[model samples]
Target: MITILMGSIAIGLSLGVLGSGGSILTVPVLAYGLGQTEKQAIASALLIVGLISSVSSFSGIRQRLVHWPLVWLFGLPGMVGTYLGAWFASFTTGIVQMTVFATVMLAAAWRMFKPSKAAPETRSEPSNWLTGFQGLLVGVLTGFVGVGGGFLIVPALVLLSGLAMRTAVATSLVIIVMNSFIGFLKYQQVLTESQTQLNWHIIMVMTAIGIAGSLTGQRLSGRLPQQKIKSAFSIFLILMAGFILYQSLPALFPAFTL
Candidate 1:
């Protein structure tokens, strides 16, 4: 319980400080701490992350940092894509899902190591279409692997939606909430089909602690050296990714594992 509580704080703090990585943290907490199967963990992660991001994004909305035009331009299609991906996951094995998830963790680590500093985006008919298409792709990855897609969405907003970095980050949060909740609904159906009783206790605890932790982290973000923090966290992500891959691979390729 202590470990789970600690992990919950870390999950929300990571997002509050970094504006991403909450989903990355949530799954392991549920899977390893709560002894949930991968699919269950993934399902739980979506809710936890969605709740935390809602709080964080609310701040941005209050500040008027969000770009509403971009939210609709990208998010509505993303909801559809997320649903498609979650549906696909129903046919997949946990090992297969975890393997893909570990791979995505490495990508997220790389993103943290080299965060985007893109020029302001250009809006046009063709570019708008491209942005929506990219949203679909990112949404699929999010729903399939249970990530927030913020790392991917932030960059896309900068390069494709003509948003300032702050606005892009804020807008990405809204989009994540939109896409993630739809994904969560689909995954719940998956859980129901598998006869799993979704654990609301841990979810509620994690969500509550996570929100408070995020508030603390936001306060601390101003005091801390951000790049150094993200650098260290990225290395931690790499190690965790490696561990996830190691755990899943032996079961996947038994003959080659040794």
Candidate 2:
């Protein structure tokens, strides 16, 4: 219980502080800390993260950091994609799932490490068509792996839309929440079939505590040197990715193990 609480706070703090990278930690914490099966952990984590990110994005909204145009532009189609991805995930094996998770994290890490800084975004209304297309692509990725699409959204906002990092992060949070909901619905089918019951009390308590911690971290985001922090985080994620890949490979290729 204590470990779960601690892990939740840690994840929330990371989300609040880093914005996009926090979702990557959800699976490991749920699986390792709460002693959940891979499927249950991933599904439950998606539910929790969706809620948590929604709240966090609200804070960004409070701070006037959210970009509404981008949110719709990216989140609309993403919702559909998320459903498709979740359905696909149901057919995947644990080894394959972990491998895919690790690969995605690694790619996120690489993106964070070498972020492209160029023009700042101007606050303006966006076209409906653009939001729909981006949302579809992001949603598919999110639904497929039970991951927040912030990893992809952040870059797209920064590069294509010319938004600031904070704005990109804020927008990513909103998009992630919507996409997560889509994934959560698909995941529920499996959970119901398996008769899984998450520790809701624990989940609730952890989420409450995490919200406080995340808010504090969010306040610090503007003050901190994000690049340095992102680089350090990227290194940590890379190490974790390497370890996960190493462990899962043996199972995927049993012949190589012998």
Candidate 3:
């Protein structure tokens, strides 16, 4: 229990500092630390990520950092995609889900390691069609992997929609909240009684600790050099991805392992 709480706090801190990665960590924490099945971990992660992002978003809303128009354009279609992805996830095997999730972590780490481009001086809103398409793609990934997808959404908003980095980060939180909630609902539709009971226990403890850690992380973000932090985090993700692949592949292909 203590270890799980510590892991949850780490997950929240990642989100607070990077505005991403929390959901990415949550699945592993729940699965390995708490002994949840992949599907159970994914479902629980969606709820935790959604609630944490929603709470974190209030600060952005207060500062007027969020772009409302972008949220509407990107979030509605994302909800639909999230639902579809969650439905598809229900039929997948545990090893298959973990393997896909590890792949996503590798992709995210690669993106993080790349040099960040400067934001455009003159911003223009992305076309509705373009925003919707990106949102749908991100949402599907989020639902499938139980991640918030902020790592993807933040860059898309900056490059595709021409949002400033700050605005993009804030706006991505809103999209994540929408995607996570919808995905969680869909995932929950197939949960067993035992899973529900275990999830409840996990959720209550993790959410409380996670929220507290997020607040602490927000404070630290102001003082820390963000690029250095992101670099370190990217390396951590790469290591985690390797570990996940090593653990999951054997189960996925036992004969090949021999």
Question: TM-score of each candidate?
Answer: 0.94, 0.89, 0.94
lDDT scores in order: 0.85, 0.78, 0.85
Whose TM-score is higher: candidate 2's or candidate 3's? Answer: 3
The residue pairs in collision within model 3 are none
lDDT of 3: 0.85
lDDT by residue (tens digit), candidate 2, 137-242: 6677676667786767887787778787778888888888888887988889977876877767766776776777688889887798888988988898899888
The lDDT, on a scale of 0 to 1, for candidate 2 is 0.78
TM-score, cand. 2: 0.89
Per-candidate Cα RMSD to the true structure, in Å, reads 1.8, 2.7, 1.8
Off by over 4 Å in 3: 122-125, 193-197
Model 3 residue 11 CA deviation (Å) reads: 1.4
Q: How far is candidate 2 from the true structure (C-alpha RMSD, Å)?
A: 2.7
* Cα lDDT of model 1 by residue, 137-234, tens digit: 88898899899898788877776656777787778888888988999999999999889977999899999999988878877877887778878888
